[model samples]
Each structure stands twice: as structure tokens, then as C-alpha cells.
Target: MAIHFFEEDIRSEIQQKRNLKNWIKKVAAGKSFRIGNINYIFCTDEYLLEINKAYLNHDTLTDIITFDQSERFGEIDADIYISAERIRENADILGKTYQEELRRVLIHGILHLCGHRDKSPAEKKSMREEEDKALNLFDSADVPRGTLKK
Candidate 1:
């Protein structure tokens, strides 16, 4: 299971590919069964908006959009598009940093691939709980991973 991160930022920030890859592997170790290929595209909201419209038929702003391309041959091919712009906006709205919101969104997508759905009110609540659990595990420190509330 390889987690590949592609940054489309003209001015690349402090995203460490190795650390992010390790985190992904740790989170997906026994879940999702990511085997062959997994791609994460980090970009601006404009880019993700275009992707949302083109791929999902939704023309609204979102933080992350995941496309499962896994075939019957067990090749887990998938694309997860993350919107940094929306993350920043959401972080401000939730009184957290961009990193916090980004991490939450990142785990949200991973849980999605792990058969976690958040389409309904109850599902959304459960998904939030799972996201918090994942974040706590991912952090494993006393500093508290994020400031966002479920």
C-alpha cells in the first residue's frame, strides 16, 4: 500500500511527503485495504471546484473530494483531491489552524475509503466521532491534535 501525495501548489508549503505517507500507511494499515495505488492531489479551491463539477456533478465548494477507482482485480486505484483554500476557510470558521482542519479532512477521506459513510445526520455524527478517534491516534500526544469540535 503506497500513499502518493502530489502538491499542485505554485508556492509549496511545509507538507512533508514522507511524514504524510507514513501517517496514511499507519491509518490505513488494517483498514480500507489500500493495495495497489493511491493518489492524493492537494490543490486550491478553484481546482477542486473544477474537479467537483467535472467528476461528481456537484458545483459547490468542498474541502475534499474522493474518487474510488478500485477495480475488480484488487488494484486499489483511487484519487483524493484536497482543497487547501477551503481548509483554511473552515479552519477560520471553526477557530482552528489550517493544519488542524486539513488533518481532519484528510482523515475524513481515508475513513470514507474504509467504508465509513457520512450521508445522513446520524452517519455524519458517527463519521465525526471516527474522525476524532483517528486524529487522536494519529497524534498520540497530550497536546491535542486539533481544536475543531465534533
Candidate 2:
């Protein structure tokens, strides 16, 4: 499984770590973890706003918007468009580092592609549980408090 970033590079991500790959695999195993390509495109609010309007027909600002392009299971293919600007704001509200929040948003999109939906109350609860599970596994190391950054 490959995790790649397209334009608007996502630097400072933990995905590049060797241990991170193993951690992700362990968390995703027995799930629909595919051995194919998945693209994560990070962009500005304006870029994502255009995509959200043109594709999803929504005007509200969002942190992560995923476009799944797979035809079958075990072929996890998707484009996750993340708005750094939105995530930064969410980091403040959530009282977590931007990195932690970024990790949450990344897992959120992946969980969606894993046949997990966060629509109704029950589904939202389940989704949150899954997110917490993943975070518990991945956030063992202290997540650095993000400094004032633009």
C-alpha cells in the first residue's frame, strides 16, 4: 500500500516513518486494506473550496474531502483533499497539535473508504470509536504541540 501526496506537498507527516507503515498495516489489517495506490492531495482552502463546490456542491469549509476511485475491495484507491487552513483552525478548537489533527483527518477519510460511514448518530459514534482506536495506537509517542504557524 502506498500513501502519496500530490501537489501542495504535505511535509512533516509521519507516514514516511518505517514504524508508521507497520502501525498502519496493523490497524488496517483484516479491513479492506488494499495494496494499490491512494493519493492524498493537500491544498489551500480556495483550491478545496473550488473542488467542494464543483464536485460535492457544498460551499462550507471542510478539513478533508475524499474522492474514492476504486471499483472493488482490497484496491484502496482514493484522493483525499485536505484543507490545511481548515485543519489548523480545527486544531485550535480540538486542543491538539496540528499534526495530531492532521492525523485524525487522514484516518477519517481512510475509514470512510473502509466502508465506515459517519452519517447518522449511531454511525457517527462508531466512526468516532474507530478514530479513537486508531489514535490510541498511533499517538503513543507524544504529539508535539504545533507552534504558531501559518
Candidate 3:
């Protein structure tokens, strides 16, 4: 069970990896799922856009794209790509700090692996509620500040 963070065409890093990993585990456990190898590939909007176009065939910018590769039930094995550029812009627009938006995106991918969908209005509402619960957990936990260099 591991969570790895990497950057592609970006200069950002998750400094509090240990805390973040533990928090992720807790979140998965809450959903009755176990953590497997999860790779978080952070990149620029352009980089993620290329991926979106090549793989998803969508020529639109998105905050995150999750690829689920679980081989068994209750085990998460996936690669999640995030756009740091979008996170920053979203933070400004939503009046949230950069760290807050980043954490939301991070857990949003995990929630997706846990079978949360946001395609419909009801699903989107439920997804947001789940995200809020996870964020509350993060707020009450002993996690440190997230660092992402622009």
C-alpha cells in the first residue's frame, strides 16, 4: 500500500508525504477499501490537456483524471493526474487557499477510486459531500501545510 507523488512539467512537491499518506489510508478505510499503489502525477494544465486529448479524447481542461487499475475488490490501484495550473486558478476563483484546493483535488481522486462519481447532478452533490467529509478529517488531523511551488 503506497501513495507516490510525481511531477511532470511542474516544480511542485508534497512535503508532508507521511501525513498525507496516513490521511489517505484513513479515508479509504472509511469507505471499506484498502490502499494499493496509487501514483499522483502532478503537471501543468497544458500537459494534462494533452493527456486529456490523447487518452480521454476530450479537448477540455480538467482538474484531475483518474485511471483505476484495481485488480480486486476493496483494493485501490490507480494513477491520478492533476493539473497544478488549474488548482491555482480554481483556488483564486473559489476563494480558497492553494493548499486547500490542492488537498481537495488530491482526495477527490481517491474518492473516485472509492466509487464516487460526479457525472450527474446527484452524484456531483454526493461527491462534494464526501469531499467535505474528507476535508474535515484532514482539518482535524495532524497534517501539516501542503507545499506546491509554481
By lDDT, the best candidate is 3
Q: Write the per-residue lDDT of candidate 2 for residues 61-117, one digit (tens) a residue.
A: 888899988887667778889988778889999898887887788788888888899
TM-score of 2: 0.81
TM-scores for every predicted model: 0.81, 0.81, 0.92
Which candidate achieves the best TM-score against the true structure?
3
Tens digits of per-residue lDDT for model 3 on 2-78?
98899998865455677678788989999999999999999999999999999999999999999999999999999
Q: Give the Cα error of residue 87 in candidate 3, in Å.
A: 0.6
| Model 3 per-residue lDDT at 92 | 100
What is candidate 1's lDDT per residue for 54-138, written digit by digit as tens?
Answer: 9889999998998888774334568888887788888899999776787788778887877889999999999999888877766
lDDT of model 1 at position 102: 77
What are the runs in model 2 whose C-alpha is more than 4 Å off?
7-21, 140-150
Better of 2 and 3 by lDDT: 3
Q: Which portions of model 1 miss their true places by more than 4 Å?
A: 9-16, 72-76, 141-150
